[model samples]
Target: MAQKQNTLRVGLVGAGIGGLAAAIAIARAGADVTVLEAAQELGEIGAGIQMTPNAARLLRAWGVDKVIGDNLVRFEELNLRRKDGTKVGGGPTIRVEKTLGQPWWLVHRAHLHEGLVDVARKNGCDIHIDSRVASISYQTPGPVQVQTERGATFSFDLLIGSDGVGSIVRRTLFPSVKPSPPTTNCAYRAVVPYSQIRKDPSLVELVSKPTMEVWMAPHAYIITYPISAGKDFNMVLSHHRPNPVIAVEDVDMNDFRNDYRDFDPRIRKIIDMVPTAKRWPLLVTGPLDTWSSPQKNVVLMGDAAHSMVNHMAQGAATAMEDGAFLGRVLRETVSGRLSLAEAITIYEKSRMPKAYFKQQVSFLNGYIWHLPEGQAAINRDKAMEVELKGEQPMRTPNLYVDPTTVLEVYGYDAEADADEAIRSFLEQHESKDESTGITKKEADKILNWFLPEEERFLIPSKF
Candidate 1:
């Protein structure tokens, strides 16, 4: 089987980073694609979204940097601290873009989204607003139909569920399951103007320039970095909780004076500086039993696949890397000698193990974040002691599988690969078919066989 063009059509069910990136990838591959978003306006709020070295390479290819040139900022260092604002560890930050032969940048969430949308449409994807993906059916040779919220029905060569954790596409295809519960942890998210916080002697160190800072406290952590150049700061405060999941929309920023009372005095000062905030209850997703639909044509991606705790900051980055890799896998399978099943097989075989490893690592990090109060103090003291004794500072471990190592994933161009994959997929399907077209029994066999016994759900690169 070789790549074929039978109108390589794709239906994407989300307009966030994953869906948008996939749209750019597939459309670049010369496939006709449609991106659907449930929200009337698909944009994330203000913040510094970091793109590590690995993921940045693909963005360079997608022209993300040039699109957000002035709006994005690059961090110059990574600094760590003890709970009470005591300096515990420090080091020169690796310039992700320079290290990986691409640009690593931070931008307001809205800016990144708008840039991606613009490029996606420029590349020829049909993006629809407020067209929620209600249900997906794939009783046909490929993805058969997708029913929309507006009572619209459409068919495509493939249907991708890039929707978030509550993916309706996933719900309709897989068995019913309850949502993940809060883990007694929560994050206070804020996007504040640089001009305001820049006045605080302690806080000003953060945004008077471009850098990423992680101030660890006895029971919680604070992260702040530049996004959209020096225009704003993306700040988040995480706390140790027997439970931490607080929905952002449900939060009252004014009450935090009490919420963080027992913690470090410096943290209280930081909280006071934050005039507005969103609360997101930290929730942990159990390891997915499997992520593919019975049809195999409809598979989950990004948070819909595996939503991880933000401990690693690889959530969105992971999704971007996944999109690039997915495009690569298709390109490899279809453009060359493998069948469609063969192509997907290559993809799962290559990606599942790594994805599973990262998922488990996220779980482990969550355990670290939830270290018991007294135990947390002990660990902090130990870390602090080591820093003092060694006369050297501790560094942030690459808790993530660096996105830059993905020469095998996003490195390959989606267009060239898709051209090849389409032919290969079609040939394989053609070889297995009869003039009478697919018989019911044969169709069932194909569907069942293509439906992997188990598939790993992957999230974004801090994606």
Candidate 2:
């Protein structure tokens, strides 16, 4: 007779997007999940987030799409231009949805966070906002133990560090790992009301429809898109500096306008209309040798595992992917099909290389986009122009429109990939033993577990 398996208890640090996402995914898979956040209140500080198809599909599966409600903006077109408003590249993103089976979305960071939190709670996640982690014990333990700053202690079968760039859980697990160094790049983020944008005839076109626009220049670029259901225009302005401080501080409006003084007149007007903005110093962490403790019970996910700059606009998307993938693999462990160690091994093996690749690509994208005015920049512009005109199927300098990159980045299916990995592992390990060998019946059960009825998880359109 087989022993009855108890539900897996998962302790997750951080209640941010990634943590909440993990909570929802794991809880839905029958794990008892608890989330601890350092902040007294749950919220996000950024202006807007680009929820690409890869992450959007996971959100849809977890029913967070419905929770987003009126805050979601589905844009199908992106326009890329030079500093003087010369159109360089960009086109319709409708093909992306058609190819990838999910639509790209834009939303305020706070709104998305709220939606994730709501769905996580509905999925039975016990989230404690004021519980700051003081220390963690995983070195010699049957279960990982966490101590909060308030002297409260909790133990769990698994500990996930989904905490942001500064992750205490990660630090505890890997004492030798150093903090991410500050870069010479920084970004200013702000949200302008559509009503304010309407005041200027030149800006009215920007809000007339759901679209994304990027104006590129030497060592700087400005990206804008509609958020809050087209009621607001979110702007992210990236630039270089000789000495950039690592902090989020209020921008000096005068200095901010002067920095982009050479841009188009319309851009200058838009900058002037901005009442306030916050400057965020870009920081990135190099790939670590591993993202798991020696015991494998304690692991890292999201930014805690692979923090990258926002150059690719994939920082949040990749974090969501990490959470989703972890949840999928851990489900097998909960079902007694795989050990916790085996599940963590699969996760580390599959996610580490992909996440590290994205990190390097994102860093390289920053260099590409911030090239000085020279032959390199001109060649980049010419390539984008040719690609936009459909003259050839060759790779474009703009990653957003590059066919290969678009497919690789947006067309990924985390659940499917995890299922395949599980299948391969079972075939290799379980097939060797006659008693433990996977039978047809067992394989069918695993397939069913991976592919639940689509209708059961579909988000309603009128939610």
User: Model 2, 290-408: lDDT tens per residue?
Assistant: 89988889999888888888878888888888888888888888788888888899999998998888887788777777788999989988888865674434598788767788788
* lDDT per model vs. reference: 0.63, 0.83
Candidate 1 C-alpha lDDT tens digits along 282-341: 554435666665556776677777666777666676677667766765544344544445
Query: Highest TM-score: which candidate?
Result: 2
Q: What number of clashing residue pairs does each candidate have, in the order they appear?
A: 52, 0
Q: Positional deviation of 228 in candidate 2, in angstroms?
A: 0.4
All candidates: TM-score = 0.79, 0.91
